[model samples]
Target: MRADRLISILMMLQMEGRMTAAELARRLEVSERTIYRDMDALSISGVPVYADPGVGGGFVLPANYKMTIGGLTTAEIQAVFMHLAGGSFEQLGIGPPLRSALLKLLHALPDQSRRDAEWIQQRIYLDPESWSQDEKTAPYLQAAQQAIWEQHAVTMTYTSREGHELCLKLKPYGLVAKAGVWFLVGETEGNVRAFRLLRIDSLEGKQEERFVRPEDFDLQVFWQEWLEKYESR
Candidate 1:
């Protein structure tokens, strides 16, 4: 969390041009003293950040200074890719930046690291069926996650257990894949619904408009409730 906080601070400074230590602490939910310490750490480590105590001064980095993760070890690089693989690369907004970052990481490695990375990929295989209703749906799981995270609506045709079929436009809230099936939880108009990905005929989404996900919502709680309801049926 500390590392993530530091990265966020740096990025905030980069985006906002300048930010006071108090403001940084408030944003990161840390003490002003901690922000000072983090700033010191960044500056000493060649970050080229500067902070001033005057009324109109705060941390600032040079306009063209770019940070690169081009020195990670093979294991570190592989970890990055493995994390990215957890969701649909096509739909997650982080995918493009991750791909670019991955390329830099791979290019920075030595020849041995590159070979080891390939070996790691070959050996590290996931059994998607155990995680989903069917492994065939794994690729589209990311699509559901993306819609949820972006608050975009999704349109999919799903089949029911009783052999019924329906096409729906859902406000995708979250995705859960377990026991070899994936489910999308969201509301259609004002009704909550869950659809098994394996039964979905086609999936589509657009970001033309978005909605705010509820603040008091928890995916796990919703899931448990759904399970209880299912068992009672």
Candidate 2:
């Protein structure tokens, strides 16, 4: 955590040009003495850090001293890389791009920080079932994400547990993940419904019937409304 703070302080100086010790102390939630010690630690560790001892100067890293994702203080990179690898951010399809970005950022980090990043990568992981095994709604989930972004309409063949197959055409509002299941919540026949993705049989989208969503549409409110509908309370 101290290392992370050190990196953040350097980054702030790099971004903000300069800051006073009091300001840094407030931002860091530490004392001025602690800030001084941290500055000393950073300088001793080969970070091009310095403080101007005057009425105007506090602490600053070189203007060119930016925190490259490559130069991250290990834990930062691991947190991001793990999120990408874990399929949590799979919706973006930028997983490989993120990995490459992390590598580029790694190049800017100190040698010790780089080693820490590698160690963190090796230690932490997120292993969820592949989207393909979802059987029922994988395709629909993908479609819903697309529709949410593109403002398109989607049609799906949905089956209830009673084995009734119904064709639904709706304006896709949002895609939500709840309790390991994917739900596509949208307006169907003038009412909102949360359709289980896996239970959706055949899905397709048409580009012609697009409509503008209300500017006030709030996901949290929609979710609460959905819950109310579910309980019939």
Candidate 3:
């Protein structure tokens, strides 16, 4: 994720104007030495960054050099940030990187577009969790996310409705978040099913075993049918 970190540093400098090495190290959870190396990498890549020496000095990106997203209108910028308000990004352990990327986009937006996006962000609030339920945890969500994205199988022990611990090797096709809960939708036993990640006692990706996702599978259609059956039962 060095690339991501590098981009984050760039965006951070663009937004903050100046940041000390120690501050960047603490925020990024890396050593100060790593920050120095990253700065070198950035400079070598021709990014216009420099260190300010003396009292109250820090890494600086010039104020006059601005990056702007020219094609996107103010309305489009609003739409992007509005979709980002839901809490699902944090559920899958993607909150930090996702937010960082959003910041990058927000910084690149034109002055008026950025103002509108910030206005909507301040006014609107979204809570995806259900009022009737407590928060659910899915410790294996990161693993499931990796497996699904790489088209690999996952080995896990799933707690069945009958309270039996069943071993499974699942080829994850997609993951669905419903009512603030995460579900792993995958192929097992020659059938597609959804497994609640909380019920998974243990999970690991089978990196050596990859599978082709069914080309005809429609995740939305399947989820609708699955929901109907669950409700009827």
Across residues 1-233, which tens digit of lDDT does each residue of candidate 2 receive? 78778877877888778888888897799999888898889888888887778788877766666565554435556676666565534543556877787787666577887777678778877765556565323655666788888888888899987899999898888877653467788888987778888888888888887977776677777887887877794
For candidate 1, the lDDT comes to 0.75
What 10-residue stretch in candidate 3 is worst by lDDT?
A: 66-75
lDDT of 1 by residue, 1-233 (tens): 66767778877887888899888997798999999999988888788898766889988888887655444467676786676554343333465887787677667667787777667777785443344334544445777888887899888888799888888888888877654467889988797777877777788887886888887777788899899999899
TM-score of each predicted structure versus truth:
0.51, 0.55, 0.62
Candidate 1 lands at a TM-score of 0.51
Would you list the C-alpha lDDT of every candidate in the order shown? 0.75, 0.75, 0.86
Model 3 off-target regions past 4 Å? 1-76, 129-134
Q: Which of 1 and 3 is ahead in TM-score?
A: 3
CA shift of 229, model 2, Å: 7.8
* RMSD score of candidate 3 (Å): 14.5
